[model samples]
Target: MDCGIILPSVSPNSNYFSVHASPRSPCIMVRCQQKEGQVKNNHHYNELPLLKRKRPTMINIPVDRSLENNNIMNTSRVRVQEVEVEEDGYGVYSKKGISRTRLEDRYSANFASDAHGKSKQALFGIFDGHGGAKAAEFAAAKLGNIILDYLRRGDKSMIEENIKNGYLAADEEFLKGNATGGVCCVTALVQHGSLIVSNVGDCRAVISKAGVAEPLTNDHNPSREDEKLRIESKGGYVDCCNGVWRIQGSLAVSRAIGDQHLKQWVTAEPDTQILTIKPDFQFLILASDGLWNKVSNQEAVDVIQPFFTAGSNKPELKNACRKLVELSISRGSNDDTSVMVVQLDKFAH
Candidate 1:
């Protein structure tokens, strides 16, 4: 699985700040040193869609720790549905959840290549759509491109600033139709042996380094103390329904890309995390709430690590992804689910 790039996997320096946690909610928040009476809205956050009470009950699914030591061939319950993926220094896979009739989840993988077909840079993401799929569908196709355009400017100083602008631009562009619905997003960008992760809402990103799960994004649920305070400060209220805290008694997440009607409270700005790919950074798991709600971070990592470590040839990330989706379904994930497994060929060497 060597792609000619190997990096250190731990001791990451945290440089990511979001409008959501700060002023709060995005790779999109822009803080300013303003005087009294002046406010800056650099964070391109928006309110969420107000609908009937929607809370997916969180179910604790116990992981069989012994499964981690077994070979993939021995795992009879898991099937190998390996998609014929075009490899450019990475292996990837994703699937729709078992609960939804109309799959609203969407994702994308973009690799910047040279003439010989080797990849120099890559971007991957997972988007969980609620209300409808249009917003999720739109962001999957556009966010990466927007960021790439910014990088082409050759201004490392503005990399973060530009990426934030990209989210804002995407949000602005989508709102042109005054469209309905919202999407939670988690994205990873790999370049110069560094991984930049940005997220909004409950969709998450986690990297398994040295066989340990290191979380890269925060789940922006209304129940989180920080989130509750932010919403309250805005004169909004958080209430528990069916055992889940929701903003304004309707939306479950505090930040998202759309939800035009709830813009005042729910934001689109994503929190960001930057990590230099370490030697032990094996792979990354990016998924929607359905998977996260059902699978604990360590459980998810422990399940997949054995596959990469024991296999003779490179472990198929697609198979690992499929097994994870299956795990979530078996664990009672009652919403649309999506997962992407990224084999960090560069780091695993």
Candidate 2:
């Protein structure tokens, strides 16, 4: 991945700052110094201060900006896209928080099938990373496949058990990577007119029923009574850091995919729920805590409801996703935000 950073000149002779991404890691390193023999060329050079005399050239890395197919449109800060699925119409939008330079949130949406490609299943998920983005990236790339693999190789009759095991399997696989930090997740699986929703940590899934907003997954925060008890049972304590409660006064959520340091208290087993698609069910929203920290479940649905009132098309869904991200940022949420909208009507039997 290519990232850009701008640095200010510190001395009168300093001409520019050379910035490049580190090959060993994701960090961007900058070398700021005076260009030995460069002459000032701008007419206003004499009037401007050393810092303003010469500006560092910025390199813009263009991401997918197309509206057709499944490509994502990425600006310097935001990325929006329509998922390339044959049946469900869903859109994804994400923005890096103002507090951070790199975006840590990751998402996944696709269809899975058995060996013969007969049983098609839809999966959608959002992952919010803390400390680093590795955990989120790993989970986003692997979780869906792991779950689908269970259904393919294992007993399909015990769907809930299989899903729960699938989560544990993914968590175990992530731990083996020896990566730092962790990620919160929320996923939606659709098959046979059933919407199976699961979550670990604070990422959430909300559904629009008729015109009302209903939450499907409960956020797994230490503030919850059961979560608090579970943490304490593992000999971990929860403390109020500022206004938010955190597990062992370090992590905010009680469950996650990585965080090997706190694996004792931070479990990865998700809470899963299965809902039969009804006529009233309109659409589903999956987002990270960044959006929830500012927008309420009802408010989110209210904002998106208008976009789908006419019809759930790709462009309209993209607009709805963009609006939700913009709304969260406008409300002073500086955390990385990711929002996905899945039209449930198309999946209804």
| Model 2 global lDDT (CA atoms, 0 to 1) | 0.78
RMSD of 1: 24.7
Error of 2 at 202 (Å): 0.5
Listed in order, each prediction's TM-score against the native is: 0.72, 0.76
User: In candidate 2, where is summed lDDT lowest over 10 consecutive residues?
Assistant: 67-76
> TM-score of the candidate numbered 1?
0.72
Off by over 4 Å in 1: 1-95, 114-117, 346-349
Q: Model 2: per-residue lDDT, tens digit, 1-349?
A: 3333333334444575445443544444555444466453332333222221233344333233332223222222433222222223777777778787667777777575569865456888898989877788788778888988887788877888888898999999999989999999999998888999999999999999997999999999999999998889879999999999998789989999999999999999999999999888989999999999999999999999998776535436766887998899999999888888998765544
lDDT of each: 0.70, 0.78
Overlapping backbone residue pairs in candidate 2 total 0
- Candidate 2, which segments miss by more than 4 Å at Cα? 1-88, 113-119, 311-315
After TM-score superposition, the amount by which residue 8's alpha carbon in candidate 2 deviates from its true location, in angstroms, is: 29
Return the lDDT, model 2, position 343.
86
lDDT of 1 by residue, 221-252 (tens): 99899999999999899999999888888899
